[model samples]
Target: MTRGSLRRIPLRIFSGLLFAALLDSQALAAAPPEVPPPYIAAPAWVLMDHDSGQVLAEHNADKSLPPASLTKLMTAYVLFGKLKSGNLKLDDRIDISQQAWNAKGARLFLRPGSSVRAEDLLKGLIVLSANDAAIALAERVAGSEINFVAEMNAVAHRIGLDHTVFMNATGHDEKGHAATARDLARLAAALIREFPEYYRWFSLKEFSDGRITQYNHNALLWRDLTVDGVKTGQSHSAGFCLIASAHRDGMRLIAVVLGAQDENARVEDGQRLLEHGFRRFETRLLYAADIPAVRPRIWMGDQSTIPLGVGRNLYLTLPRGWHEKLHARVTVRESLNAPVQRGQAVGTIALDLDREPLAEFPLVALKQVGEGNLFQRTIDKIQLWLQ
Candidate 1:
């Protein structure tokens, strides 16, 4: 084949447990169409499969609405960055300002004109959804809530939260403070994936600040053992909102509920969304980064061949019975030359399920290749001329 032309090749068949699972899935493949996803009661909601980053179900996911205290998810993400970069420390004492002390809605009740540890303040922000704690942490990290909110908006843009706008760190009722359910779901997933170390604090049921104790506003943690950390919010204008995450049997799902009727409605909406995702879909790992499933020939190079595969963990989320219909194939560009770098795109790995397009990922070189020897190069040049 000429340069830039594609040569198609099949991947080796699976064996062992994966084979058995696929064989089992064959029976389920011909079943009736999947049932409709659960109906969410909130004004906006999203259910995301964490492993695959796929939206299983959503309603009004892109409509801008008040996030209420759920805005702290972004605030916590910012603070976690400061902690990781050594710009701030958990033990650092933050001097309380009048603004923080007077922050209404939810209060941590920090002593007037006293200093508090950054770690404790985080606990209050996440578990208690305390407005005062959000202000204090903002001041500690960015010198003031105003500056911290700027940092928050910058981070939001950097992380692909294009539909969100943060007016305050505490998620108070501001005229312009808004985030879509889809954006909030992405934000929650980012917090879980980027800061596993700090995410554990969100699961705390209760936190004590010497004089007072407050319980986490996310009620799903108490109702379901599988449910873990996430923030909750309620305001006169925003209604009730919850971003709930739950893990079961190695699979995790994130559910975002916004503008629910009441606190109980938010929890119920979020839980049902999570349940719908785990029950209807399953996430599978297809390939690990740097591990090649295909090795096509390489011409006029130091190496005779190059392995082609994904550059990151490749995952697919599908209905429980569709695994048997998922197929992967590679199409490599022909007549590849020398000096290919590791991780450079070489071809395309096309994925299809039930004979329909699912996703496509770049098949990359698993190893580098340099020029071939002079003698080998001369012979290859002659062979190329003849062809």
Candidate 2:
């Protein structure tokens, strides 16, 4: 069902007993279909809706684990911030440091003192999973890897990645370089939503620098046409990890699979989560932002009524067959007075799954309401006293 099809609960001050009765009546409104989430194969995994920021399914989603190359997602986030702030440029040449040249694991074969464009380094960091490239980019952005890691952690905190910490630029299995599936999913959403312009690079299948060519490690890109991006990581300590995003029809999903046994297991787990999310859940835009939801009477005001609504669109990620059962209740202040300003938090909109509340949204005054003239104010005062 669409947004217009949703049955709205009328504006009314419900008595406690009446409210409880209505909840019972609402519970029998619709017989919701059974759509259970599939079991995720990884130790830590999360499937999230891109538009509504809803978690469809997860296992050990908040458990901290080594990020491996999944740490690169945060690295890319920090770099994207620098690029947006004009602190770094894609075309600017970055000097390769000795530390980068001597780095272990995947390599871009950059000789010490050789200058490479930041754009090229990005390709190496993503497609190639090059440790040296990650270090070089980090050094260029923060002057040293040590300071760059600090920036990464700071960005993690700023973005509300509560379960993430970075001890190095590369997803090298350091003692403290760790992240959770939930945090990685949030990182993936931030990268795609906040920096769509730069996120395009994650879709590239391969990057070749004359002599050597490197293909992206994410296998879903080849197997599924809708699969686009994200990143992959692996180490003895962290296990194989993959963060993947896919767009199907008009919906997009981000899947994080960590601590898988092997490459195939990680890829399979990510694919399964994405498939289940798209098949089982559907995102519906229920309410437009800043629109009048309720008109509650204002006492002693020039205008007798004031509008109320949430400031943003209310998009709900619901089960495939549960749309008609969804309804919302509007609760407003009992003693609303004159001089109410626009954008004020006057009430709340609570969406319900029968008697259980699915989500709650704030209701705000849509327009200003000036105090009434002396006569109206005096009448309201007398009414208040009589009550």
Candidate 3:
């Protein structure tokens, strides 16, 4: 063949390869099935895996709205903190003030000048959503409701709840008393994490004083065995709200719903979110803080192999049905130099299910790997040069 013909042959082959690559790309793009949106009817909602903090579903989750009685969750959190700190005792008696007795929201029938223990007040607030009980507790804790509200806001800031503002511990529908579903979920998470002992109060289906019995507002507790505690709320402007948590198969999930039409709607939507999470997803431990997940090569270092670990516990929430399809890929430098400190990011551990990356965590050096001596360095350099 002539010189021009020879060049044209290779050009034609290259063009053919390029065209085939484009077609493959288009075909692959088309091959991926579209994922349908979650089934939800709430105006604002969020569902997250408790252990992994994986967001399973969200709809206007950041939109601030009246929290109603769900604001009590933060109140409960603050009270629990005081209890844990020994500043308040559950058995300590509280005198009901006129302000607490005159509170307008839900009531536990607390009478002014009556004495009730702190634990009993907590039961009233959590189980009955009693405004009187909340006010009494607030005043007892901080000397006034106004002062208690300042404490609530301070705790909110410390917990990273940026969108929440508490005007009343009872979650009354004040003009500026508002929070987002995401914030409420975060509050729930904090409650679960910080005061696990106190969280049991949320699971009480029925609580009673000597004269009367009050049932919990959360209906899911009776219907679902997995569901334990959380809170619910309702008001004219707030619509209906519910924060529900369930534990199943060693996985815990939190669902928050806001702006539903009624109690039934709120419960139903919350249940749906919880069901979707538990049925569809699972929690997998990817790595532990001190446990090495990968072994990275070391060059010009004191050690031949370096252990790579996660800085914190790594947990992933992925599709339950896709567990068999899960795969892990650890990417690290073929060889690392000395002076590697503990907790320094050495690489990444990527987790994939169904060929899609679900989560990625930083792989860090588990221990300090120092620079090698002159003799070892010379040997490593010689070996690398030979290769």
Candidate 4:
């Protein structure tokens, strides 16, 4: 039964949808393909729609492999947290150690027994892919690189990077240190979403310490004006890897290319993947947070009904012009009685594209509804019993 046909506690199946865009099948450019045509030539790769949390294209995305210098992404993530929490400051000077000075793969030319500003170290790690800067930042935060590695792993697991294991902060070639393409994509998304203020640093094409200047290894910054900050990695084992993010026409996409042939190939793979996502798919805003999708009866409450909605702005991504077949079915599992608190999950809203399940989200109370007075409760009870 449809949501509107029922007078009693009802299920909101999409006989009539809450969103008109889902049903409006206007010409939205030619459909790209039923599936993302194979174009990328990497061991593993993924293209994600950042707004909808959807993977538009992926290949062997779950296979764990060394991420190389991309491990520095995690180092910056942890350090940004320290700065955000006021435990550290950009101007604060961090002491460099001999071990960090001896960092093997890449160096920021940091010297032992000398201190550098946190901001400069951060730029070095981001712009130059500096191993020495990664080590120094880790030591400054966690007393040692080993301890910092533990923190990195903990954060990884907590943030749902199940296939990842970080052995160092530098993304160096180390045994037992690997990350899946999908996990790395998620990490980049998290870094951007969590630290937007600091994330602008990734877009800096070049960083200078007055004495020396180095350019960012991520070539897309120069090639594509739409592309912004992200990272790149290379190693003998991992070959080459890059995670790039681009914003265009109010949509953002994250593309991950791992185990590529060379630096140029990785850049090409990233650009191709991002272009594929933007060209092939479209993201739509489904529901704004705290806005009611349905107002269900709240028996024995101060109010007659409570507005139920999502906790955050809801978005859906699908192949171009395919939203015509989308259906959002909401099922209210609870009786939806009084004393409902704001943000309480009352039911689930499920989505189906062409009758195939696509996504689901919790339907939450948008505002509090207190219990009714004695007279109101008595009347509601009688009405409920009769019904």
Query: In order, what lDDT does every prediction score?
Result: 0.81, 0.82, 0.79, 0.82
- Comparing 2 and 4 by lDDT, which wins? 4
lDDT (C-alpha) at residue 58 in model 2? 85
lDDT score, candidate 1, position 253 = 88
Report the error of model 4 at residue 169, Å. Answer: 0.8
After superposition, the stretches of candidate 3 with alpha carbons farther than 4 Å from their true spots are 1-38, 295-306, 333-341, 352-359, 367-387
Ranking by lDDT: 4, 2, 1, 3
Compare candidates 3 and 4 on TM-score and give the better one: 4
lDDT, candidate 3, 1-387, per-residue tens = 211111111000011010000111111211222224467888999997776665678999889899999999988898998899899999999999999999986788888999999999998999989889999999999999999999999999987788989888888788999999888987897788677788989999988988899899999999899999899898888998999999887778899999999889998999889888877777765555666766656777888677876666656555655556656666675456777998888676665556765455566888988899999889989987897
TM-score ranking from best candidate downward: 1, 4, 2, 3
Q: Candidate 2 residues 1-387, lDDT tens each?
A: 111133457323111110000121122233344567787778889998877677788889999999898888888889999999999999999999999999899889999999999999998998878999999999998989999999999989988899898899888888877899999998898889888898988998999978788899889989999998989889999999999999887678999999999999998898999989999988665665655776777788887778777755556566886766677877787688989998888777877665566666667887899999999888878877897
RMSD of each: 5.4, 7.4, 11.1, 5.8
In model 1, which regions exceed 4 Å deviation?
1-35, 375-387
Q: Which is the winner by lDDT between candidate 1 and candidate 3?
A: 1
**Regions of model 4 farther than 4 Å from truth:** 1-33, 333-335, 355-357, 379-387
Collision pairs in model 4: none
Q: Local error of candidate 2 at 87, Å?
A: 0.9
The candidate scoring highest on lDDT is 4
Q: For each predicted model, how many residue pairs clash, with residues at least 3 apart or on different chains?
A: 0, 1, 0, 0
